[model samples]
Target: MGDFNQSVVLEAIRRSGEGSSRIELAEATGLSAQTVTNITRRLLDDGLIREAGRTINGPGKPRVTLRLVPDSRFAVGVHLDPAVMTFVLLDLSGAVVRRTSAHTPDMEPRRIVEAMAATIDALITGSGVDRTSIAGVGIAAPGPLDAEKGTVIDPPKLRGWNRVPLQAVLAEATGFPVVLEKDTTAAAVGELWMRRASADDSFVFVYLGTGIGAALVREGEAVRGSTRNIGEVGHIIVDPDGPSCTCGSRGCVEVVCTPQAIVAQAAHAGVFPEDQGMSDVDAVEARLTELCDRAADGDALADGVLRQAAAHMSVLTAALTNMLDVDRVVFGGPFWSRLADVYLREIPDRLERASATRAVRSLPVDGTVVGDDVGAVGAGCVVLDSVLSPRASALLLGH
Candidate 1:
């Protein structure tokens, strides 16, 4: 019961960004003034909220303004990938307060889990945030994940990671609530939470990382199909006679546009070598950064590689826009950061030139402000939203 009230107070503080006066809380929540006051007092005591100046809307009268103490309760987000592991500490306002990252331990499942737990502990202690105030830990891993069981069911890239109960393991280690979601779904959560757009009914979040995939958000929820793998857009066949994908598809977006594919092409072109630490994605990303810097310095090879990659991505994006009737398209992930300028330069032009609806409506395409940590931050939001709204949170959390 007390937990429910605290959640309400925290949510009120989040909604009233500048802080809410006691009166505003009562008005907004329809809770009695006394109830609002009590919740506020408890939140203050819990160090989850604080008074910030005063509301002066009452002419000469002033009411003490209360707002979320951004650092009061922290949530740790973990994004696990084949190439990297990203950890972000988010404050109450969904703002990243601190971050730590390490290379993904591409070992056996047990070894990776052990390493992950140690890394997570180090991050928590390094951040100097209260352990108790950590609402929960959220993990974003490659699909297909069993969110209901908080496990990674089977991920193609992760060898021996089948049916791994990540949430339970993490919870046991940290003694904190832990939640798991497919990386794409986590991206969707981040997109929706940060955008704060309640009007749009259909949109797609395309994540361009080492690979290309998407999360389909329709009617305010991620499109989780019968098996919860609704938006595996990376495998959508764009060219029947093109190259083959690891997913057994030919001429798929992922086969042609992933960072791996781009670097591979550059390697084949002798721009970089197969053994110059560019075989894996993280190494390739480092090389790409150098290449991007070189491209800025007028390196013909690097410039051409990015242009070719962007051209393929533009094709993929055009196909998505034509098929989804998507009101908005969000591009995110690490590769997107490097590819954003190129995509913005070339993709929009391609979309305008090739899109079927180019004559009807504006096709809005933009990069996610939340870059590499998009998945992790969204994972935290999954827990944060749950804590803030009891009924909704309970439904998702299975509480």
Candidate 2:
């Protein structure tokens, strides 16, 4: 059977969870019953799926149901942030069987790649899963990188990473196919797949990390731009005359609304301890956490800074929703876990008041239920997506 038909049948069964009869599979995948049978037979032969008893719903004959064999395959997902490196080994069902994290080494490409290779080995070995069953590794990194070539192109604040061929290096070192994706887009994919969202649901995912970025998911597919570098929302101009950005622009969202920017604003407002140093990524993360904690504890200065940051972020969020005509926005990442409540409370009002379609619909802002490991989980989903998810592109090829 062709791979496209196989993927369609497999995805339909997988999405159905416990099981789906051949008839149900055909309906779900828009494939004929004979095609579904042929594909399922091939999948069964490959141990990718198995019959899970039979459904007898007052029928003349019992209908066989099919389910995915979760242990038949696995994949590794790596999230490389400026501050931390997270690794997760996921089974066919997208469950994280094993997970680990370590502080990201200094941004030397060779050192980071070597460390990642070791980490990948450790995760696979420690999981006790069949090594050969592992599909590949999916990596989510800060972007502006070339996704086509799988190279890391000069992400902000990460030194020594200029057009580094990360995918090829990791593939060579780990002996597994490697797929690279932008962190935000990977997270958005993770959300959609993990939630089993229908094709009609579309939303904008707002990612808050060392920096801010976004991903647009329309009809269950992430909009990968011509260069696959679409969601660099950080550069959206929020304030025309506020401050000069690194990109030689005035008051971009990235320059004014990132965690670093919030931390800087707090420091300037004399919120940090006199002896505290905010010179590096770790320090900035620590300070951001401290500020969030203080704000949660009702510290006036900390609350003011966070609210101010949320206000700036609202400008960007509102603009994105208005421009895209999307009604849903999701916030996630390490920093978002701390600031979720404040953002959920603040962003919706700004969105409704400023939205072009306020009279027709209300935009809802929600926090990620995937927790802090969203990027890592999403990274793993990239590998699963490549192997199992059905795509419309398959139709063009006559699959």
Candidate 3:
């Protein structure tokens, strides 16, 4: 309970941004003033928080404002995308202190893990931060992970990664505790942290990346599933007659709403000169970007393909929103940027038309505020969460 109280106070201070007085922290966190004083003193002594200027309240003594020391502790966030690996060093206050990325080597998974450790070492060394200040490392990888065993179970697109114990392996390699999270869920966590001040904190995050996934945020916390693998939306059917999937289903999100699928749609539409499109990650990325650019440039064929993609995506988004009953939807992932212009213009109306709650309330659609590095940033935020988020901190430290 002491740890939980401390977390509450710290989170309050972080959310306060400018800082919070002992009275403010007590009131905000529902802790007694004396308890707030003790917690703040300990936090100050631990260098996790510091006292700023004091404020006097109407004939009372000056109240010292407590603010989080952003650099008091740090965490490394790694986004293990198939095409590239991104690394970010985030301070306790959830600020990115340093960031770097490397194209994922063609080496096997074990060698790639070695490269990841090396890059992490270089990242920390380059930042000039004390090694002891790092709390842990957080990885945002493709989903269907064995969270309890810390294994990646046959993630699509990544070869030779079947039931790999990523958490244990990375921890052994880096000598820091590791937390693995689904990329989509990590992105949602990042969005929640960034939008902590928003009144309505629940939304469905529809992740567009090498795969299509969904994550739910309820109130202000990420709803990680029982297996901690919640957003496995790939097999969810979005188009009944669109495309057949490896799952023996017709028009699953995996086949209809993914970038590769959209690129395939373009290829079939002759949006490109070739009858068949590229199959590699880099080429698929380049083709998707070109398709979006052509759509932006008023090429009717490209525009038609994107609009069709948007329509298919809306089917998926509406299913999530309707089932979750969330009031808003957020779109993001590695491939989100290229399709954002068309998706933003197309999904809202389509979603509204299909929304079950349309008669009761309007659902809003928007992109993640975390931008291109959301996966990395969110992965970092997950590590910081273990230190600052009240519930997560409690779980990490135990009762």
Candidate 4:
């Protein structure tokens, strides 16, 4: 199953959904008929796939359709956000079998790992699935990650999370191999899997969590850069005259596009009070929600603040689209849903105005089909992906 040929054959059947005949698989994967026969035989014997039914394709003999066994394997995906931690159990078919979420504990990194291990235990046990059927756990965490070391390198949102070796430690604590992924990249992978996009589909995933980041998808694959950490847009100066950032830059995405930044704008506009300090994540989340609600209810000041954010975000979007030349733009993360209505309404026209290819094409902007918990769902799918859909590329998993 680790072979590239095997991955091609298995992915063909998985994508077929209704099922595919051996002849269809051979043609779809460009594998020889004999090779497809041998691989399908092994897959059926191993219970990863099964003969669903027989089909008559104007043939001499009826062709047996092969389909993936959705329940044959399971995976755990965890989204480690500073505000909330989301968990999901996914089957081989990429369906969420069970899920849960909890507020993140403000503790040391090791203590948070302990909490993750415990929650993963309850998620599997409560679902009544055997432990051995579980493949591994995938952690979608905030980045500048040391992918080779499997450690997160001081994400601003997660206090005290320095160079913690998350992959090795979580594997030891849970007794399952762990994969650490940048939350944005994981969300892109999750969208790729769930969206079932065409082979030529491409987009830039704008992940709006505690921070703002981007992920690339090219030819239906997540494009993780050299260090497995691309799309670090935090310090990209979006508004030269906007607020100052920790990186000693003014109007960076971290200071202008993030929820905290939006909340700061709201407070400054007197749409909301700034009693809670700007660094408080939960308070920022609540305030952001309220600000959105106010805008929805026709509060002009609140709308004005969000529109300004959308304008700054369009600057970021134009930068990415002009440089990358993707097919479209996708928005997702824990904070994406609340911001969707305004962002959708506001970002398109501004982006169109700033687009490098506006003359050739009108760039499409849409929210993630997988919704807010996409980070967790995509993390779980990452584990499943490592198993079924292997890529012939430089993509690297964080240990």
Instruction: Name the top lDDT candidate.
Output: 4
TM-score of 4: 0.96
1-399 in candidate 4: lDDT tens per residue? 237788889888888889899999989988889999999998998899998889887849999989999999999999999988999999998999999998788848877988899999999999999899999999999998999999999888888988989999999999999999999999999998898888889999999999999999998899999999999999999999988887888989988999988998888889877686978788889899999898899999999999999899989999999999999999999988898888999999999999989999999999999989999999998999999896875244457
Cα-based lDDT for every prediction:
0.77, 0.88, 0.89, 0.91
> Model 4: which ten-residue window has the lowest total lDDT?
390-399
Cα lDDT for residue 199, candidate 4: 80
Candidate 1 segments whose C-alpha is farther than 4 A from its true place: 1-12, 22-47, 58-61, 195-202, 218-227, 246-248, 273-279, 389-399
RMSD of each: 3.6, 1.9, 1.9, 2.4
Q: Model 1, 1-399: lDDT tens per residue? A: 556666766676686667889888888767788988888887788777888897678576799999887777778888888888888888778898888888877747877778778987888899888888899988888887776777887676677887998889888887888888778878888776676665345787888766677888877667767766666777776667768877887888766777776777777777886667655666777777876776677889888888877778777777877887888778998667777776777777777787888778888788886777898898888777676643333434433
lDDT of 3 by residue, 162-277 (tens): 88899999999999989999999999988887777453478999988888888999878889989988988888888899788999999998888888888888888888766554
Scanning candidate 2 in windows of ten residues, the lowest lDDT window is 272-281
**Estimated TM-score for each candidate:** 0.85, 0.96, 0.96, 0.96
Better of 1 and 2 by TM-score: 2
The lDDT of model 2 is 0.88
1-399, model 2: which lDDT tens digit per residue?
A: 478888888888878888899988888878898998888998999999998898887857899989999999999999999899999999998888999998898888898999999999998998899889999999999988898789989998688899999999999999999999999999998888777878788899999988789999998788878888878887798878757887899989877888877888898888985456665889889899999999999999998888888888899998899899875998998789998867877888887899999889888888876778889989899999999987878668453
Worst window of 10 by summed lDDT in candidate 3: 390-399
